[model samples]
Target: KANNTLKEIAEILMASRSVLLFTHINMDGDTLGSSVALCIALRKLGKQAHILIEDDVAAFLRFLDKGYCTYDNHIIENPDICLCIDCGDVDRFRERKEKFFEGKQKGCIDHHVTTEPFADFNFIDPTASATGEIIYELLKELPVEVDKDIASAIFAAITTDTGNFQYSNTTKRTHLIAAELWDYGVDYNEISVELYQNNRLEKLLLQTKILEQITVFAGGEAAICGVTQEMLEETEGRMEETEGMVETLRDISGIELAIFVKEVSREKCKVSMRSKKYINVAEISQKLNGGGHARAAGCTVMKSYEDTKQEMMRLAEEYLKG
Candidate 1:
């Protein structure tokens, strides 16, 4: 039933002299945090390790140390292994896919339910609440000290991915791992403040704007909203500020499905979906050529925002009837 060989993966990492970690395009907390922790662990073993993230870290997460997770690979010249952390699809590499494959070896460690093996070696554990848990296990196999920095990174990854142990994917094992990481002196209090309490006023206004004009349909079982370029310009908000806005829609009473669309361009829109009770948003996303977990999923639609919104409403109506 296990989809990974932790010992074998550990051996592969140990043998490598230089390691490069690749995070996904959007650069979520799970990918960035997991990669940072793993990179630190590799370095503690006296090997050269660096994290490669093509996109800029969001303003909220910029407080994290940049030396471990960097925008450029200035130190890593020729990596012995390139590992993708919390990256489900090759598309996540975006412009950096070539750098990922350039290493002598490649591997993937992920927790997304839709992910499959796409590297030379893969440890795909959908049961894990976050890839950080897998990295924690792998670190236990390596001969390195679990210092405060590593613990803080892993804690951030697990907490964010699990919604601070609020999401359905969180398991008993998650709490146990978190408890153990606490022993290593993780600065969890600071992480919580950065993640939840440090929202900018512009972001607050933008979220308020989204909720004020949400569209309800399918007999009020579904709610939808959008972030247009015009809206961002008006509120002085960035696209990354809209990360958790869809969850607010799902939290509304009587809402079973929530959809948030962000205008990518004049003829393209990005869609994020979240379901509270029974609807499988992942199924809907796959139908639209995207994939994710049951409760959460996303897709990119090649159509005008209005057209994409209408299509999502139609799908929500159809799915709500079940």
Candidate 2:
């Protein structure tokens, strides 16, 4: 089933002259890496390709966007195709870029289990460890070569999404692909240092604040942590700096479910959930109008911090009981 879709997508890429690729908002390594890698590969195939992102690239990921990324309000004048990568839906695109889909041929390449087909050509595989894996397979079907830049982007994408091949999503194919990417001279050591070891003082201070407020429940089986706007201001931190905070909760010896809630606005809180075993965070996120992998998922609640935390805790308790 997916092979046919990939073939069709390949045909689209082969036929298009210009392509505009989009990543989801609050971009993560997987989405940014996959989009940028695809952009580079498409350009190598002699297509005019550009990557558009709604938010500023996270400091750690700026290396991937040296000259390939564009953040301006200007739109490409009548691009031949618009490819939304790693995004579950068109609504994930920024308001400015939403119109780019209206009169153009649209396609999507994603690896989310709950994603609906929103494009003319939709290729989704929930089993793939990362969207980058899907992009790699598609690149194989095309006539492009995986250069160093492309390999690095894909390596970062798959590595981060699979938690450096430690997450449950990692499979034989994931490792095989990683081996291929390494063979392309992806600078694995540098990438790991930059991604996992290079932490700013502000981020450490923010982590301290989050740790100070960490709560344990369900007899140490569940943990919850949070950060507010004040916490961000106090630590001189931006929201993007909170990327790996939830993992800290999951790493606790007795924790099976971890929740990290951040106050994005006065009346809104973004909740990130992680489960080490048994519990399915995706189902919990779905109940909150969001979706993701079973082990890692998120949702946004339009409520006060306390209210949102209470709601998520309630859901977590219910799911943990199952």
Candidate 3:
């Protein structure tokens, strides 16, 4: 299955002159980094490749777009092929789904277990640690060079998604890939500092607020942290700054499940879920009409922050019991 999909994707890339690429809406490191790497590889092959991202580049990830032209309806161009990376479903594109690249051929490369076969050609690998790993293999099959920039992008994707090689998803292949990227002069220390160490004053203030309101339930087995609109306004922080804040809850001793609920609007809240072990947050997220990995997952609730926190807490407790 893997070989056939790779061959098909290679054929499509070889035949097409213009290619349109996309990722998910929230724009995490894995999605953005993988998309940028692929775009660079395709352009090196003398093909016209453009990344059509719908959201603003997260503050931490803006460096990946340094020399690339990531489009967002500002610059429009029709392409012969459309490819989505790290996105599980077409609906994940949101309104941009109907607006961009009505191409003749469409494909997707994703690592999510619950990914739907929404594209004409699909490469879905649940065991892979990151979509960037799959893209790395695919790049070898294509007649393109894996230069330092592309290697750095792939490194960022793999490193961030694997929690700096600390997550359970890290495997032998994951390390081998990192080793290869390192050989390409990926500057591991610099990337690590940029991704994990650097933080703005606003982000620190927002983190303080989130930590202050954390509540632990189920006898410290479950915890919940919240970020309201008012907190964002007070700190002048953007929604993207809250990226890894939920993991801080999981770090607390005795906490098995951690939930972070951020108010995106008056009646809508985004919930991020993390588990130390055992709990399949993906299943819980699916029940709430969202999907992701077992240990790390997320969902959006159309309710007040209080209601969303209560609902997620209930689900976490139920899962913890079983």
Candidate 4:
């Protein structure tokens, strides 16, 4: 549960002279866009802000300020406040946990159901479509100017996480906020081009192979695909290249649920889930010690791909049958 209100969190952020933002391990558009937008706004308020992101950021998101993405060592000095944006679990920012705790005022701004308000101040609103939506409101409280740069970042955050406004999580408020971003001159076309249209040939090849290996289950209501390190090596594709692979399965005519299993290591796998209608993939992810929205969710399992896939399929079968 969150203990602090948005205005309260904004007051703390406004009072702070320096801030450090943490993004999740696998830097996605929501986390990156929210953090970058907040950082940019904070700088406009004459505060020192930096976003500590994993070096493995996807190429598509590089349009955001790369200068802000840095480590504690890279910065001239540590910040007074540390905040994690859109990250539901502390483990997501484990690499920077120490530096995060070192801040005088620790905070979290997110829109995830499982976030527990671990920081000194927190604003976790599962009702919000994305953390970017929360950040957009936070900016109004801080009363910082929203420029084109900030607009685009937040736009990407909301757009990507909401699956370009196609996911069940998107609401009237989401569209209203998006329209406001357009008023602020956010380049929606550019964001779309970078996020969806821009693709590497190797990634396409890798996705083709994964699609060919799809396993259907739940009487064609569900499908699953496994991506191994060998497959990446074989296709000369990076792990990040498989970003939308799960959606491909869900898009099939008869499929209501889709799963993408990425073998992170020999004994560990990262899974993404998407649902068309009835299935609540978030509940499914929670069963695997993960959390997300009703239709889209993800988890990392510390088991072999075969074991993990088997368990996920069993769970999928159970949920579908119920």
For all candidates, what are the clash counts? 0, 0, 0, 0
Select the stronger candidate by lDDT from 2 and 4: 4
What tens digits encode model 3's per-residue C-alpha lDDT throughout 153-226? 99999999999999989999999999999888899988888898888988988888888988999878888988
Estimated TM-score per prediction?
Answer: 0.95, 0.96, 0.95, 0.96
- Model 2 residue runs over 4 Å out of place are 1-4
Worst 10 residues of 2 by lDDT: 94-103
lDDT for every model?
A: 0.87, 0.86, 0.85, 0.88
Encode model 1's per-residue lDDT on 1-322: one tens digit a residue.
2455988899998888999989987787889889989988888898888888788898767766558876676557767998988967878788777788788998999988888787888899889999999999988888888998888889989998888899898999999999999899987789899987888899988887877889999888899999988888999988999989998889999998999999999999999999988888999999888888889899899998889999999987876775
Model 3, residue 50: distance off in Å is 0.8
State the lDDT at 184 in candidate 2. Answer: 84
Clashing residue pairs in candidate 2 are none
Model 1, residue 35: C-alpha shift (Å):
0.6
Clashing pairs in 1: none
lDDT of 2 by residue, 57-88 (tens): 88888877868788753556778888888877
Candidate no. 4 TM-score = 0.96
Residue-level lDDT for 263 in candidate 1:
92
Clashing pairs in 3: none
RMSD of 3: 1.8
Model 4 weakest 10-residue run by lDDT: 70-79
